[model samples]
Target: MAPAITLAAEAPKLSSANTGFMLICSALVLLMTPGLAFFYGGMVRVKSTLNMLMMSFISMGIVTILWVLYGFSLAFGEHNSLIGWNSDWFGLSHIGLTELWPGYSIPVFVFMVFQMMFAIITPALISGALADRVKFSAWSLFIALWVTIVYVPVAHWVWGADGWAFKLGVIDFAGGTAVHINAGAAALGVILVIGKRVGFKKDPMRPHSLPWVMLGAGLLWFGWFGFNAGSWLGNDDGVGALMFVNTQVATAAAMLAWLAYEKIRHGAFTTLGAASGAVAGLVAITPSGGAVSPLGAIAVGAIAGVACAAAVGLKFRFGYDDSLDVVGVHMVGGIIGSLLIGFFATGKGQSAATGVFYGDHTFTQLWKQCAGVGAVLAYSLVVSAVLAFLLDKTIGMRVSEDEEISGIDQAEHAETAYDFSGAGGGVVGSVSASALATAAQTKKVDA
Candidate 1:
């Protein structure tokens, strides 16, 4: 190991090349949040499109402030089992920090910001399950609080050096249990507490725009590069290059598997099917990709894609109203990734773990993986239930019936997405000045 240095050691000595790459990596993670916004926004009803977008954008603001405030301290600060001791902001004012990853010279702050993107998006993804009903202000407050209380602690446990799980030798290269499973279970908990939206099952509510859905899918796919690759914490070295390749292959394989399954079962290739499958691949690879072999990644991704696609239908059977399939995709994909690693991981140069393929201590590793999954589900559900109850009783959750029916865009924001029909009926080009004046007045009045 390189020489250990004190906190007083001059600012971390990173190469210019490493710093440039890290900056790009940080941008990559930031991109995922907006990518998430598009992904969820397309899944909601037309009436609540803007509100759905707001739900995600709000996370960028709320989580950023919270992460800086106390969330970072609770997560990464040095201290005990339950929480961190609020060490200096990972050397905030130092201009750089010693690289934490193996053989990297990048600053610690670079890694922190990349992870921050994930912290923001995980909760934002849950908003899909609770879409179109919860009060906007209440949501803003809930996610902020949830991240600090639930997310930070768990992140500390899995990722922080002093985290219990990390100390226990549980390997989560990325956040399988911490991010995906935690968010998915928490989504279910909050949705149950908030209850179903009006006519959730009775009404055949369809997505307002499929084009928007496809666009969001593209963005998510693009941003995921930073997500899986940036986990390397530096340049395209052995680990980073390997993760980058695995991510691409697994996603392609899962996409193919999903389509093949659908064609055999449903007789048609749906765009939504392809999008869902791609995300499932991404999630399944998040934790295990760097550890597992290429063949292993393909196996995990394809299985997760097919399994998640099937799981999405369960809401209709079980009647939970997980409006946007958060449970099906994130929860199921996370379980697949976390467990598959036990069967697929192998001892490499510095990585001493081995899986069932190696036929050594397979059961023990698998058991450990299962336990991690169980812990996240139990903790997130219980904590989320309490939080949701508080919000429901205090500020209330669902909107008024009048507001609900009119749609959040107009009901809450006083705006409609499209306004082509005027007294100059179906007029594409021109409208009377008086009508234009009236429309402007109506918009101002509503605002």
Candidate 2:
């Protein structure tokens, strides 16, 4: 019957250095989800901080399970033009230890986990937009479904072996299109369906903790080294090193530009502006880091900082409450970064594709970048809106008006981020009490 069940030879030799580097990068990327939780958490009103944090934290759990079950297969398995569906790796059942991914330096398992980190953060990015109003149960359900439907397929389109964009020579060194643009569009879609947050423009709704915001932004910046440079899957190459430098350069430039814009427009260089600018820079440079020079990264970052700072106000002009500017920063920055590649790519880095500015005036690469961006944006928006609409109709997506006014953290999780009722009369006690007391007073005022 069986001619001695011959196993196929392993794909290639495993590079220990590459494997170890990837392992570190995977851990660093994993840290971004928690960093995102804190970042989003710090931006919301104190009443909903935990809920904001939970919305991001839950994605790490949900997407991890889904990735092991079938997400990996659908995303990176054997492929068609749309998506792969190989069952051989489902539940990670048959991946042999020490097995190398084909033509890659890292082991299959290490590669799997690295990709898994990407999957986790992509959905977490959406939580910033829905912020205070979403039902925790419905939000959790949305993460599972959205990642499966929108993220998986779009990931396949961009990164899978047979994905249409990958095959078309689209150069997404990281995930400007797949992750940022995808999540950004999804955020916009859900907010449109869910409508504005209760106090559309009248409420202050200012961040309760700029210190927390700064801390979270710092962590995100630290983790992004892994997010951008590690996409090369190995630190042994010059491409990875180039990307690492670009990540730093772009982020710093973006921060400066954002501060300047804020100073010019709002007449103040706020701490919040610095933090938001840095993230915009990170998002803008993600797709282009491997292909552009440090100078190019600065340009991208500067433009993104200016553009996103302005775009944030669109919520008021057109009335869609993207609570934390996910649509503005991630989506808009992603589009700018992706499109800029067609003008900045030197055809000298990891990607051999030249942009219009690099003596290639045909704009061929530019059009491909647009297609990649447009496809992900359209699919993610439509699918996310449909999911939100359905969830709103069935299980109800938003919390009750009373719950929202009171504080989603207490309403949903029965926990507060800070408790002042049991503390001593030190500075910590005084600050916590004042913050909580002020929050309670505000709730009373709203009531």
**Pick by TM-score: which candidate is best?**
2
TM-score of each: 0.89, 0.93
Candidate 1 lDDT over 1-447, as tens digits, reads 111234645434566777677778778777877877787788788789888888889999988877766676678776875577555664354333555432356665665677778888889888888888888888888997789789998888877767777666566667888889999999989988988888988988777776777787778778787787777675534777777877887888888888888899899998888888898888888888888878888998899889988888888898887988899999888888888878888766115677787675637667777777888888998899899999899998778878888887776667766666674354654556668889999999999
Candidates' lDDT values, in order? Answer: 0.79, 0.90
Worst-scoring 10-residue span by lDDT in model 2: 1-10
Q: Which pairs of residues collide in candidate 1?
A: none
- Residue 369 lDDT in model 1? 78
- Cα misplacement distance, residue 384 of candidate 1 (Å): 0.9
Query: Model 2: per-residue lDDT, tens digit, 346-405?
Result: 888876799998977889999999999999999999999999999999999999998989
Models, CA RMSD each: 6.9, 6.3
